[model samples]
Target chain A: MRPLIRMAWATSRRLLLLMSPLLAFYLALMVVHQVTKRGTDIPAIAFTCMFMLIIVSTFQGLTFDVEGFMASLPVTRAQLVRTKYLLSFLGLLAGLALTLAVAGLAHALAPGRAAAPTPEELRSAVALALVDAFGLFAFLPFVHAFEPSRGILAFSLAAILALAASLAGWGLDGAADLFRFFQRVLAQPAPALGLIGGLLAFGLLSLSLSTWAYARRSF
Target chain B: MANLLELRNLSKSHGAFNLRDVDLAVPAGTITGLIGANGAGKSTLLKLVLGLLPLDGGEIRLFGEDARLGGARLRQRIGFVQESPTLFPLLRVDELGEVVAPFYPRWDRATYRRICDAFELPRKTAFARLSQGSRMKAALALALSHEAELLLLDEPTSGLDPLMRRDLLDLLLEVIQDEGRAVLFSTHITSDLERVADHVAILKAGRLVLAGAKDDLLESWALVRGGEELLEGPLKDRCRGGERTELGLTLLCEGAGSLASLLPDGALQERPSLEDLVYFHDRGKESLCAR
Candidate 1:
């Protein structure tokens, strides 16, 4: 556990350093959007870019020779994978907090020009981020199991296929009814709690898969 | 003396290269030099013992426990230095030490500092900024500071200057003087092994061709030079690896005592060096079957 924490700290430090430029650019863009009254989804756009960058950087770091160095240590592969997952989760949490802070600052600077996110909008954004985080987190196991290029291709294919399935589902006769059901569920507190519970379970499932793949890996 | 490290029926295959049924043991208080040519599976074997590579078949026991089942706990008792130190490049030397020290239960900070001073390592320099030799020294410092009972090193001396190599060897010798510790290092440099290694294990084309006490192996094989007539006579079958020089036929033969009776009066016999053994074993096609 100590090794895991140490590794996570080191990984987070490197991630923060690597993303500093992008973070600055996003902040500048937020300020401009607020000043010009462009009415852009600044928080969402920033979140999306930051999320993608985090995923790419985390994958690159894991697949690089860093894995070799870590393997040589006294830590087991399961511990290493868990540390990576912890680091990625921390990165997402930090990115979300920074994005929200920037958005709040932008709102404060131009009170009448751009509106701040309402409570509902903030809740929805957090929920969506949680879902995206889990989806991205699940791909880490595949990345560890395959070569870099193949891993990227596999992740891309999985994303495309999922998108296609969602689109195809929307074309079905009962699709609108299912969408209305989800809307009602989100509107109610108890059902929303259930949704969050389900997402957490899914995330844990992904972590289990990653641990299995990593433990079986041969350096 | 108990064996600190043991391997039996160890086997792994990577395409054309195969480590077949390797059996070895390293007793405590001795340095075992694993000498082999390039691509001779030295690194592969080391990695397997470290659990970096999965074994196709075999058992690795370090300190009387099965290595695979021992997990990180057993690994704490061992230290390893790879051919290229795969340390994080962005971290400074001190930061790297801080990160790794917590993993080993017996980490000795005072010893680490002492080794750092002795090696003349720059603690504040980023790993990428250090010279190759310095980076290796940093790695060595970390490995030695752990109070490990067994050390596994792969090509640790390959890139250093002669003086640094001597210093590293002396350090290893000092480490093994405690008698409760052991070192297994792989290198193509036989002279280094000749200087410090109590036992020598020679690998050729992924198989351990010869392994035993260094002195005993040298005494067993004799380098003999005789006329061409000896090649066609009774000595032909006994010759391990031979070259037809302009002067005569030079060969390595196992039975030195019997060679005196079979060869002509002018035949010469000399002790074979580790290099001669590896050269003849790897390069001499007929020598492969002779072993």
Candidate 2:
């Protein structure tokens, strides 16, 4: 367990280092948006960066030679897989905290033009991020089974397709209706709890699949 | 003497290569040198014993317990140094040690530091920044610090300068002198083994062709050089492997006493080295195929 935690910390440290440049870019964009009094979608931008971080970090964890080295140690396959998930979870929390801080700074800087996020908006952002983050988390095991570069390519393709679907959703009446339904669900506590529950179950299922694949891997 | 490691009917196959029905043992307090050609399944056998690769068939018993059932706990008692250093390149040497130390219950920080100091390993240097020799030394330090009973090293001496190789071999000898520790290191460097290995196992094309006490193997096999006519007549069946030159035929044969009796007084009978055994064994296979 200590080994796993140590691995998680190492992974998280690497992930943060890799994400630093992109984080700087996002911060620059936020500052520009604040000074110009432009209406930037803060939550959406934060979520995108979070998703990218997760993808990049997952790719790094799966592709590193350290995985083989770790396997040679007295650590089990299950523990290795679990450490990956733990890293992703920790990265998510860190990313969200950073995003929140950036959004707060943007609001504070341009108090007359930009408004602070409402409590309801914060709830929706948190709930939506959870769903998106866990949805991506579910694919990590499968991604990990691939070569690191290929895994990143695959994740990038999936992310692009998802972006395309979201863009295409604006054209579909049923999609708008679904968005309205989500807004209503986010306003209430019960359905939001159900959504979070469903996401957790799906994430766990993905984790189990990853563990099975990793356990059977040759190295 | 009790066997520290045992393999019975072990088998594994990958594409055109197959390691078939291998049965071998290493007694406690002895260094067993696993020598073979480039594709001779030496690494495959070590990986199998380490449980890095799942077995296609057979059983591996270490410390009188099934290796598969031994799980992570069993692995804790065995240390391994791969042909390439497998430590994380991004981490400093000290950080890599910290990351790996918690996995083994018997990890000794003092020993790790001692080895690092002796090896002249740069504790603050990232693995990627270290020289190949330095990385190997760091790897040795980690493997030794765990207090493992059995050390399974795959080509630990490869790529090192003669001085470094000798140093590592000396360290291996020092480890086995404890009487509770045993080592099985695979190498193409026969001279290194000649200096230290008590038991030698020769693998040829995935098969354990010859294995025994190193001194006994040297004593039993003789390198015979005699006339080609002698090879064709008296030594035809006796010669393990030979090539006919214009002057004579050089042959590696078993049973030195028999060869001395059969050969003419002009024929040369010399003691076989580990390299001689491997060369003749490989040539023997080629000749068998040609026939």
Candidate 3:
């Protein structure tokens, strides 16, 4: 457990340092959104850019031949794979928490009476987070398994798919269908429970893929 | 003496390059120098032992146990120095140690500090900023600090100056003086091995061509210098490999002392060095089947 912590610190320290400025920028954008409420789209654009940066940067630790270095150590490849999934899961939760915080602050600072977050708003946040998480886990395994270029290529393909999704209106159509489906599911008492299960399932699947890749890889 | 590490029928395939079925052993209280050409799979063999590369066949036994590397046994028992040091570029030497130390249960802080001081390594310097030689020194120091039973070093002396190489070799001798510790040192500088290595293993194009005690190998392998006519003589049958020098033909023969009687007057028969073993292995197509 101590070795795990030390290895985690070694690999994630750079990502943590890099996240500080991104977090600040995110919080600052939230502040701007609450002040005007007029340029709501601005925050989404900023959020998308920051989230993509995070996706790309998630495996930046692997770029410096960390695989070879870590391979030399006593830590099992299984443990390394587990650590990656663990960090990514934590990052996903952190992203959702930040969204909730921003939402709460917006409600508190409103000119009108403070109210709990609407069901629609909650669903929107969940949808966005899932899509982002899906995009991340898709690339994380390949990046960790192979060379750094695999990460770049994976993300590049993602960007292209995202562009195509927007150009062809697949993103809008899918989101509208998703919103309707969630609107009904949100009426259920344990909607959050279901979402958590889905997230775990996805995380586990990603973990298995990466573990297999890392296990078979040669430094 | 007990073998600290053993590789039996170890093999790996990377496209056209394949590390064929090869066997070698490192006994405790000995330093076995691994010598080979660049593509001869010295680094590959080291990686296979560390489980950095997947083994295609056979088994690796560590400390008399059929072992899987990257496990608790490997973590506590082996220290590895890569051909190119892979210490984190952003971390200082001390910081890298701080991270690596916890992984090994028996890590001694005092030993680490002493080695750092002895190596004259800048504890504050980030690994990326260190010179190639300094980086190698830092890596070796870190490995030594752990006091692992088996040290797997790949090309550790490649970047050092002559004096530094001598110092590192001397340090290795000091370390091997300990009862149960051993090292598999891979280097192009066979002279360093000649100075310190008790045993030698030479690889050629991914095959273990020759491996045995240094003294015995030197005693049996002979370098013969004579006219081109020698290559046409019955002596040619004994030559493992031959190269043309400015003066005449030089043949590397396996039966060392026996060659002296066979060579004509004015022809020379001397014991072959480790360098000669590697050069002859590369220059000769046929493997030196004799150890």
Candidate 4:
């Protein structure tokens, strides 16, 4: 019932209404892919879905010009920004959890159709999710500052440049190799903590940039 | 009169336009009409007060507290209805209330419901689907339901029909019966202000040319009408602005009691309306320069 949480809940409900069909369609597809023992690796698909959901939800959450209405309320710009960040991260986490939970449930229900997902595959999926989330730092400010069309363009450009840079660090196999390289790095404790610390620091910077960009705007 | 809201040396710059050094006070138990042409910064001033737009420089004191930074605490005591009410477009009349209610600790849902009923607002209809009058009424009802001490309304009557405008003005008069509540209403429609305004501020190009009690201002100014020949010369010199209509000549000037002896037969003199004030002042700038 707190104002900030209420705003988060309100926004989440709206986004969920829009996201429901897209999410249901994807989850059904995931279930069928699992049962039919399909072509693509399950973890890769899950990572891709998480990235899409996080980015799409970010766009949906901010597309409305509700600043005038929201600012007029008893909430601060910082609180509004916090709601956005909270809703986005919560979307990412929920999608990942729901995919795993729903897939596990499907596999359990139809045991004859598909084998239980391996722990290694789940771990790799988790690593991929981490990388995708880390990539979000590149364009979180864009999401706050620009409209959807421009924001998505900036995000696409960032993704392309990131992939190009990653190819030099890993092999030419691109995303799969990038995933393998990060998986190896995450296995090492010191480097894993360092990556997380870097992500946290980057996240704080993104938050600051987002807040500054949002505050400058007049409704 | 104790001022409930005061804007001291307020200024804001938006690219090509700047509102500079405006000082106005709204006392309790009175309605202050802010009148201006389009793009004259009426909405901008209102937004700055409500904290929707940050002030580049100056101080806003509401209930005697520094509101220059505009926050929830300051906004809670003020109810604002923008020209068209920028609420969530998709939420129905009732649903939007639920979202807005939690923010206002003093929100009264029962009173909101009563006002909605009184306005005959259709709670089930999409807010966008409602007629302009109905939409404005819904917005006004919502603003009143919060029990805010001061209401800042920007152009609340610009688009309504004559009947609707009358009803809206009447409702506004009724709301201000509680002496703790005051209103700062902005509109270009001087007639609406004539019906309800106690104080009037006329803005021209982002600055207030005139601001004070309505009756006192009208009492001090005069409108003179006569043949074009008698009014054309040095009398035009004394008049702030003049126009030669089909009726011959009309002039707006101060101190008409002294000028009465100078006018020829068939000359007419009377008090100026709010419309006359704006029209003469606007034309005064151009006509005076041409002369």
Cα misplacement distance, residue B72 of candidate 1 (Å): 1.1
In model 4, the runs with Cα more than 4 Å from the true position are A38-41, A44-57, A146-181, B128-133, B227-238, B256-266, B288-291
Clashes of 4: 0
Kindly list the per-residue Cα lDDT of model 3 for residues B46-81, writing each as its tens digit: 998888888899899999887674355665788888
Residues A56-125 of candidate 2: C-alpha lDDT, one tens digit per residue: 5555556557665677888788887877777677667666776677767777788766667677667655
CA error at residue A213 for candidate 1, angstroms: 1.9
Query: How many Å off is the CA of B120 in candidate 3?
Result: 2.2
lDDT of 1 at A100: 72
DockQ of each: 0.55, 0.57, 0.57, 0.56
Give one digit per residue, the lDDT tens place, for model 1 in B94-180: 887888899898998888888888878888888879898888888888899998899999888977889889989999999999899
Candidate 4 lDDT tens digits, A77-107:
7777777776667767865786577567667
**Candidate 4 chain B lDDT trough over 10 residues, lowest sum:** B282-291
Using DockQ, rank the candidates from best to worst. Answer: 3, 2, 4, 1
How displaced is residue B287 in candidate 2, in Å? 2.0
Candidate 3 chain B, poorest ten consecutive residues by summed lDDT: B282-291
True contacts kept of each: 0.55, 0.55, 0.65, 0.57
TM-score of chain A of each: 0.81, 0.77, 0.70, 0.79
